[model samples]
Target: MEMHIRSLTKPDGRQLRLYSRHPIEHVENAPSPFPDPLHANPHMRWHPLRGEWITYAAYRQGRTFLPPPEYNPLAVTRTPDNPTELPPGDWDVAVFDNRFPSLSLEAHHPPETIVPTMPSTGKCEVVVFTQDPQSALGKLPLAHIELLLQVWAERTLQLGRHPDIQYVLPFENRGAEVGVTLHHPHGQIYAYPVVPPVPGRMMQIAAEHYSQHGRGPLEMLIEQELACDKRLIYRGEHAVAFVPVCARYPYEVWVAPIKAVPSFVELDEEQRADLARALKTVLMKYEALWNRPFPYLMAWYQAPTDEQWHPEAHLHAEFYPPYRTPDKLKYLAGTELAAGLFAMDVLPEDKALELQNVTVQLEEPAHA
Candidate 1:
């Protein structure tokens, strides 16, 4: 898989990168809506009881909200006067520095707090999935989707090289119910100075499991799921998607490679191809379930970029849809919010069956 990339500096001194499978023929200078350079200085405060860092970025409140269709910021710049984030190009995907980042590499000057405080010297980047604002991730061509996976691998490698960045997370929040301010098909990457609490706990558990059994918990679970043939959504040669036996959400689904691949960069060509199909299968099922665009939070988990070999870490994607039923939503209550325990009304098997019933047809990979 050969990927052509071009990097440019926006007017605001932000980095913009354009990627495509084919050689990029047309190009325009990158533009920014904001004329001034970024002044991002986020800080992290220690939570004594929780044993975690809480980041505070007051500028995020002023980020772009649900703007009118005419003012879509992710759209390609149409005129010189009306500039958008992306320039006119033949790029399959675009990535740029977030104008209102929660964490920044330029962050400094920790506030004088009683508790521990430090500069959030991390990175935040926005990934525009496509030039078309109307299309969704699952709707893209298989080859295009594969390119995205490659792009993610590239980003992980680039961000992980920074000594200050210990972990990198790529995630997407779709629909207004999930507090998606922008209707554009996009996602964000957050590189952390230290491994966050959730991933830290997950890594600890995986490490323990690996030490005891010589395999990660997710790897063991995948074997059991494939053997049982129950709660399986998509079962490809190199990858699989299913609802876990211990799913926290009613319609939760997980997509992963059959092998215990640690991160995006570790995915082989066959694994990457099959993983893309598995992802598309689950997403298409979500939209077909209700015959409308589905709303969900998709997060990818992988090994931390702390310059350590992690045989315990397994690469996977988790989908947490907001809706339990067609018209009903699964709202988090006291137990879920306060106590961190989730109570599901429906069974994981039933939800799996529901998704299994929805049929989706995918087209072959496209090439020019």
Candidate 2:
């Protein structure tokens, strides 16, 4: 479970860290497409009606989007003259400070407005899943996938230690349908100064449920899903993946450890390994189900990183696929958008059957 890390400061003053199972040696300094220093000064405004904070970063409009097939910024730097975000090295994963982040640690000087305003004092980072831009997460080896879980655990522990950060969310948006301009297999980490609305309500409800019954809501749901076995996709020794009975999306699926592990930092070796298996199973099924690349928003939810124990929090991942069928997409409109209530056209059991029919063989790479 040992990981070697090499930290480097990019020419543009951004931070880059490379991780590997073996020693990360003989790697050149990190590179950046921009040469000038990035002076990010994002701010947050209070929404009186929603009772929440809204972050603003006008510069994010200029972020790299839909680049030509020849040029990928996430790719390893080929020549020193035209460098990319990463250095050519034998690293499994790479993480760097986002050039156009919605929130920044250096944010300051909020402008006067009618609503309350403050500096967006948080962090946004991009996690490059692999060196190859064409590869997908499910195509990775099990050992490599396990390494990603470890990387997430390390990031959560490090970012959570900051006093200004209250919550950390790791999520991925796949395909152009999900507004992913970059086709690279990667995800993002958002360390928030405050707990966001969705996870905030989730924690509140979980705490209430845990108080009434000595288990979290997800844990109780997991027990029921396991007992029912109708919507079950992959049920491992320590982890499980299933379609929830009350799914909001047409092809929605949930993955989690059998036992309630509050966060990635608390997952044992068994739980982490099994969790990777379950994740890969779902991703592979999604691809095979439609005979094409599936587009989905995958989000991992854990406890708030406010330096307090949260026994009610249960670590889990939810996958919201956009497609209702092979060709048609399920759009959120009317009641779904205005009322915050999701309308599903298909049943969860029916969608679960579609994924369960696809067979996937988890094989290790020859080198591994």
Q: What C-alpha lDDT do the candidate models reach, one value each?
A: 0.92, 0.91
Can you write out model 2's per-residue Cα lDDT over 75-143, one digit (the tens) per residue? Answer: 998999887888998899999999888889999999999999999988899999999888999888888
By lDDT, the best candidate is 1
Q: How well is each residue in 242-329 modelled by candidate 1, as lDDT tens digits?
A: 9999999889999999989999999999999999999998988998998899999999999999999999999999999999888899
TM-score of each: 0.97, 0.97
Give the C-alpha lDDT of model 1.
0.92
Candidate 2 global CA lDDT score: 0.91
Weakest ten-residue segment in model 2 by summed lDDT? 359-368
Model 2: residues with Cα > 4 Å off, grouped in runs:
62-69, 364-368
Error of 2 at 330 (Å): 0.9
* Residue pairs of candidate 1 with colliding backbone atoms: none
